[model samples]
Target: MTKFSDFANTLQASDIAELLALTEKPEVISFAGGLPAPELFPIEEMKQVDQAIYEKEGRQAVQYGTTEGDVPLREEIAKRMKKSFFVDCEPKDIVVTTGSQQALFILSQILVNKDETIAMESPSYMGAIMAFDPVRPKYIEVPTDDKGIVPEELDAILAKDDSVRMIYVIPEFQNPTGITWPVERRKAFMDVINKYDVVVVEDDPYGEIRYDIEKLPSLKSMDTQGKVVFLGSFSKIFMPGLRLGWTIANPEIIDKFVKFKQAVDLGTSTFGQRQAAYYCQMFDMDAHIKEINALYAKRRDLMCESMKKYFPKECTFTYPQGGLFTWVTLPKELDAKELMPKCLEKDVAYVPGGIFYPNGGNGNHFRLNYSNMPEDRIVEGIKRLGEVLTEALAK
Candidate 1:
């Protein structure tokens, strides 16, 4: 028999991963993965961009680059940080990561030791939990509501637990929940954070995919003490296959992060970095994002409308102002995980909500993603899901 490290021994296929595999069949209308619309990918523009890189930079385009990442891409990201996120940062403050996924793992490794507590919103992003799991840190789920993480609950948690070293949050278009913190809540949350000495990992992958709400100031923008580490991704706005993301932090954190990342993959793809940089220089990115926003908004509306029309009266869900997902809560007696197999029988699927809660037991909720499905599929899938829910409730 083979032996493994304790952390390696603890690894098992995630419930989400298993569920996603089931949904991979051609007939299944899956709302499981947080997938962006592939139809919108700039394939033709990328061909031109690739040709330009090879023609202009030759071997340099594909050569081993600095661990800090491509300078021009970092500069462009700095400009985007100022223009879109309201955070004024320079290229020096940024470190290009493999993806925000890698950043999560490295931050957890560097910032926390075993048994130290990491605070997160109740029923937070499961992927973050997976990333942090390798460190074997204790997790404290701060109470969260429609507006986002409750400040009073977080303040009390922080005041009582000095072991809590880091707090992870997705302020805008939060995964699974689709909740955006209001400016007042953001300020109040920051005030509480200012009183504590913990680092805040502000993951904002879906902030740019807005539909109705005005742009809100990021927690990083309000970070006066350099306590916030902002993570940005090109996946939602650009291409996920490129596997590119960036991190902005205090110089000390950036230094440690770059050194650790050097050990991880040497650096993010050199040619991939140039692809994003050249594409930004040559094309209208804002216009492309606007196009994504329009399509997703239509899908969101159709899904919500279908849910309203077909779902049982006891079911409730969020109509997100912007972002890819709508969070649904079933009546307390019904478990989403239990209902999922029935939905699969109907050739439709959604992510079970129980896995989102680190400490477990919010089994009545499920998350639905609208960005990857067509309008007809969204309507048809919801109708099937509603039937499953209605049948489950009847029992």
Candidate 2:
């Protein structure tokens, strides 16, 4: 028998993946996947960009490019970042990634060695948790409130423990919870980081998807000490199929990421990068995002309203200003993980909240994504989920 590397043992299958598989069933109304609506994908626009890139550049469009990513796309990303997030960086400071997902993996690779610590919110993005887990970092769940990660709590944790090297956060329309950090909290968070030697990974995938309020200034914008590494993605605002995202950091850090990225996949798809760049030049992304935001806002409103009507009085959920998901918290006696199959029986599915926690004890909460479904489906799914929850609460 051949012996397998111990690395394989560190990776456990994702429960979210298992839950999302229910989406394959036609009868299953799933809020489990944080997916953009298929109807909203810019198919015709992408077709034009694809043809233009191929016709204009020929083999160059498809050829293997630099590990740092396409210059044009990076410049475009830089411009948008400056205009929106208040962060300024040249194209050279950017490293294009296959997606923001790859950026997270790369950060884990570079920042975390065995037994090193990285702190994140108590119920953070599960995808990020999975990325960091394989590196075998000691996971610390920082306390968070409606405003975002508590600064004093983070300071206390960092002060007592020197093992912590990275602080990962999703301040704008944070995944699962749909919570955005207030400006004061963002400044306080940065002030705490400035006091320490820790690096902050600011993931901003949903920053542009706001429904009502204006987007807040990113932590990178407030970063004065160059301790912030920012990751942005087209996956939320633009189509995810393009798989284009970028990382912005100081040149020294970006250089290391470029070299590390070269070893991972050599480079991301050149054709994809060129096509995205062409599209960015030719199209109005902000206007397109407005259309997306309008669609999702309606769906979010419908879901929240339905939850209000259908869920038990004891149950509560977040009202997202802008983002794909809202967090649902049930009464303490209820277990969302156990309630899942019951909800599935009623042809509705959700991501039980336990998996979102790094250490995995919270089971009375769940996350519902309203972006993937139509308004009617969102209403119906929440209605069914509400029935399940009410029944569980009664029992």
Candidate 3:
């Protein structure tokens, strides 16, 4: 029998999907997976990209491209990012990645070491945490409120520790939480980091999904000292199946990420990158996103109303303006993981909120994603969940 290394021992499987895998409960409406609605996909636009890809760039799209990424695709991504984030940027600052997941992997390689520590929000994105866990760094959970991470706490931590090299953040409509950091908070968060020597890996996958309001400025847009390395993905807006994303950073770090990617998989799929580029340029992105937002907004409205109608008054949840998840906190004594089996038995599944915390500590909370299911399913599922909870608490 071969023994595995200490590094492999540090990684554990994520429970998000495992809860869903237990049974195909017909009545199960899962908020376990942070999935986007398939109906929102602009399939017709993608078909255009498919045709254009073969007609215009078939040879290049199919063949091996440079590890740095295809130049034209990178340029398109950069241009769009600059307009969206309202920040000055150049094509040289971008590196197209296989998914935002790969961007996390490359960053883990570049910035994290076995002995170093990463400061991150409590109940942050699980996928990001899981991506960095295999590298085996000390995980420090920073305290964040509905407004976002407390600046004083972060400043105090940074002031006390010289060893803290990196801080991971999801500033816009964060996964599991669905809490967008207000502009003033983004300013304060940026202000504190500006004084410190630490680096911020800004995650912004859901920034563009705003339904009720205009988009907020990104951390990278406000970054003046070149201290922020921003990550973006096409997964939420377009389709996760494309597996396309990009990282924006200083030339120095972009070079390292590019080199790390070269050693990892050489480059993101040339076809995928080209496909996204085509979707952006040729498609009616504004009209497409409007339709997506309208659908998700309706779903969100239904869930909120259903939760209020069925859930106990003691249960409180965040009302997200955009993005997929609604973070719910039951009574302090009621454990979320403990509630899982009962909820599943009732055929309603949700992600236990503890997994999102880098240090694994949010036991009373659960995340509900309204992005994937139909409005009828959303209503029915929440009603079922309400009955289970109502019955359990009465015991």
Q: Candidate 3 at residue 294, lDDT?
A: 86
Ranking by TM-score: 1, 2, 3
Candidate 3 C-alpha lDDT tens digits along 1-395: 77889887655654655776863565677877778999778777777789998999768778987777778878887776877777678778888888899998789879888868899988788888778877778877888999888888999999988778889998888887888888999999999999988889998888788878778888999999999999888898888998888899998898888888988998788888778777777877767777888889999999999999999888999999898899999887888888898988878899888888777666889999999989888899999889977876787
**Predicted structure with the largest lDDT when compared to the true one:** 1
> Model 2 — which ten-residue stretch has the worst lDDT?
9-18
* Ranking of all candidate structures by their lDDT, best first: 1, 2, 3
TM values, all candidates: 0.99, 0.98, 0.96
Which runs in model 1 stand beyond 4 Å of their true positions?
14-16
Per-residue lDDT tens digits for candidate 2, residues 121-146, read 97899989888877889899999999
- Output the better candidate (2/3) by lDDT: 2
Q: lDDT for model 2, on a 0 to 1 scale?
A: 0.89
Task: Give the CA lDDT, 0 to 100, for residue 63 in model 2.
Answer: 78
**Local distance difference test scores for all models:** 0.94, 0.89, 0.85
